[model samples]
Target: MHKPVLTIFYQFNPWYSTIGGIQTLINTFIKYAPNEFEVRLVGTGSDRTQKVGKWQEAELAGREISFFPLFTLENDNFRSLIPTTLKYAAALVGHSFASDFMHFHRLEPSLAALNWQGEKTLFIHNDIQTQIKAAGDKNAILWRRFPAAYFALESLLVRQFSQVFSCNTDSAQLYRQRYPSMGDRVKYIKNSFDNEIFYPLSRTEREAQRHELAKRLGLSEETRFILFAGRLHPQKDPILLVRAIAALNEPHTHLLIAGDGELAADIRTEIAQLGLSNRVTMLGALPIEDLAQLHRISNVFVLSSAYEGLPLVVLEALASGTPVVTTRCGETPKLLATDNGVVCEVRSPECLADSLQQIILHPENYPSTSCVRAAQPYAARTVMRDVYSGMFTRWEKRTLSIAS
Candidate 1:
């Protein structure tokens, strides 16, 4: 019998990740894991109180996952993540000593499993300091003292892990650029999505759903709804989106802004000041299920954030067969390459509006389903198959060498 494997993740926006790309990877792992290995997953939920108990668990076909949400959003304090991480690490080490491998998504939580010392792999979600640096442009003070701890996972930290899995080549290149000594250790792992949930709906269904949503939202059939489905914050450039929408010369083009954030009020003010109160709809913070429905109803999907780590929203939109336009954030190169989505200049509404106008009018020509299906291979099942096959080959070689 083989020892189990433990997968760890950082779930800052827990609700979003649960329904996003990483969720697809986790769920896929559950669906098609090999019998030789048992897998346990751990995540830090938004609320630390949501940690796993006996009654709370995730049931996959092959294995039952005992999950504990270590730290919650409300409970983030000084070293809270550190101590809570240690507690979970202790639990995994003490009771689940059979775990032979620990795969991590973010830097901090992986530190908790530092002592497990088995085969360790860190997935580069993004360069946190780069994001903070970009965000600092708008809110100078909050990030003025950006913590030194999270600045860059340089040589020392990179060497600590046995392997590194980056979301894209750019992310890996950044790491290699920062820590050339460990350049050979980092690898690329594309995010995945399930085609079943994300594929294009039938024309009839889409038309019907759009009609009903239009009626509910007081939109007419002639109204063209351009969408921005993300947090309304300085980091996302909601004002840029507003300015872009205001610049559109196309008639009947409306902007449906779904999601809420610290900058919601400010973005709303900007919209009003631009005289787009009627043209722009602010559908604040929505459920993931509803967000998908909105995508199905949308003419085009647009993301204008200043930073990202392979944002799953673009994938989700592409999966829904909705034409998309995004900025060259963290992993935009890979995303645009595979999905054929448009890349626009970040924080520039003029560029965004032009892209949006092009996507909306000629959206039918775009291969939306191709974009959705492009994510299938990176699903958990596919990744596990590759990992296990490679591991088995390596193990056999080591055993053969020993026998000789």
Candidate 2:
């Protein structure tokens, strides 16, 4: 039997191993996609010297995946993205004809494909309207200023997809409410973590690793590490994390940030102004292995996001047996219901400080086993198998109907 070709689309350089949550999810799909299907990825690559449209094939985890770049640009500025959007739309139109099924990560890149009548699936990574609102004036995106109009446009784009997958339960519920006619087409699919890479270390292993990390970072062996691993964007509120750490004020408690984005300079400034330069370490965009190691060594993980769609880092932290103290965003409350972590109010440094302090001071309340158990449901293999099975079943049914 011939295998179906699944073409996945997202607006970023596919060559980059990790970008953010959406990219991580896309990589997971590529890695764990059903063996019976052939996978192709389409995205924008950044390189001024390279041609706009090019195709390349690469093997990932023993699977041969094809990649096609929609366009190449000098930088990811607003001006360059205008042409990139047009190129992406045109590329999608051409690729849609060849694909047995299409999957899109974000709505913006698919807006121009609205008229394309094809079997397309959409993954909602965040509730855009709510995210924009939460970001308020801090977000520089043009759509943030005209939220209602943007949402209307977004709704129209959503109608193009046959099915929508939301990583956050709350976002899925909101989508269902917004598009009641779609019914069961909108699904709440939780993001997952790699159990093999992110599992908790034994007490001896963890202590030794912490000692090594402390020695490397020029901290005392007794230092308690607070981790925040995500893009340093306005939505993530990295500056607020700095403020929270400043408020935390314990000499032995240090913050380890393991990602970078546009707000990196601002976060550094905040740390300097608050006199936390020595206490906060910025480890920019680490590979998965290093990130998981950070999680293992850290005493607690923290997220101060204004909004999210079930952050993968949170799952990774939980899987690594690190207690979390995060803002009330996405499905964190549900994730923390098992007493694995604490969820605090959004955009409140004082609240974040208090929560982090609580977890640090009373570590016994959140057991490592409890944290690991809470992450069991989001194991990569189980979640991906179920997701792909459901999708392929639906596609097969549609194919049979068409033949008849």
Candidate 3:
């Protein structure tokens, strides 16, 4: 008796080793998916060639999940994506016998998945159009050249899948508006996090972890810290965080930044110009263990992003029992609706400073348990696994009914 096989068509093979929001989701699914269902991944490579590789076995949750690779032409750019989509679509159609249904991680690969003969589900993590607009002249040349074509492709892909899952309500609304025919097919599924790795620590355990982090960062144990963990990019608005911290000028308050990107130098300059060099420490990108420890020890977690698609870090912080002070971005309003943290206006250092000060002055108001409970519904193993299982069952029944 063969298990029901679900084929996930993605742009890249996010084998548990890689680090990203989507990779984390893939890993979580693999770790907790029902035993009765077998999962396989199909993806394209970065190489400038056009060929489909043989199916190979990869491990997920101590079980094997077969991986099929479709080589891309050139740099996986717009010019070469046409051929890549054709090759992958052909390969998927040829291997239709291997999969019961298909899952797509983004619009880029769904174009190919649409050609395959199976039920398809699409997971939309971000609003591409919003991001393109947010990018705002950063890559003017590329945007000018491909904006129209990209929009056409995106519009088509959004309409092709009958089952669409978005991580936030905002994206779901956008999808429904853009493709009214999709109707209730667009769902708002919150992103998940590993509760085992991010759960609240006991006071004793937290004290120990705080000591460890303070020692590692050469800080005094008495120093209260706020943590920010994400890429140091324009979209993330790390500089705004630095500016906010500087405006506060609280002697006992320190800001700990984890993660590195193009804005590292700019952040460093802002810290210096604001004379907050001593108050700020950029720990660069941190390993999962270290990041969890930082969350466990910090008095608060901060996110000053210009935009987002329901950031996993906020959930991670909440799971670790740390209150968050974040700019109103993406699904943050919904996440914080439970009184989990403070919400500030985007790109407003004054507002951010005020929110942080409020949390600081009344730290006891945000209970550790409240923060932890707010995160329970988004646990990686629990919520996301159930969502996938429910969808798979519903899709299976729908397919059977159609066949009958």
TM-score of 1: 0.78
Residue by residue across 300-383, what tens digits does model 3's lDDT show?
A: 999887667888888999999999998877887677843569988646788899999888878778888889988888988778
**Model 2, poorest ten-residue lDDT window?**
73-82
Off by over 4 Å in 1: 11-36, 44-57, 60-63, 71-98, 135-153, 337-340, 369-384, 387-404
Q: Candidate 2 — what's its lDDT? A: 0.79
TM-score to native of every candidate shown: 0.78, 0.92, 0.83
Residue-level lDDT tens digits of model 1 in 1-404: 34455554544333333333455455655556566565665655564445543224656544666565543444322223234434444444433322455666645545445556466777766655566677545442233254554455343455777678877677788877777777888778666544445567877898788777777777677776777877565666778878988888888778898876567788878887889988998987676667878877778888787777776677667777777778778785455643346778645777888888777777666665666565556544466778766655654565577689
| Global CA lDDT computed for model 3 | 0.74
The order of the candidates by TM-score, greatest first, is 2, 3, 1
Clash count, one per candidate: 6, 0, 1
List model 2 lDDT by residue over 177-240, tens digit each. Answer: 9999887889888788878789999878998999999999899998999999887777778888
Which prediction has the highest lDDT against the true structure? Answer: 2
lDDT (CA) for every model shown?
0.64, 0.79, 0.74
Q: How accurate locally is residue 47 in candidate 3, as Cα lDDT from 0 to 100?
A: 34
Candidate 3 TM-score, C-alpha based: 0.83
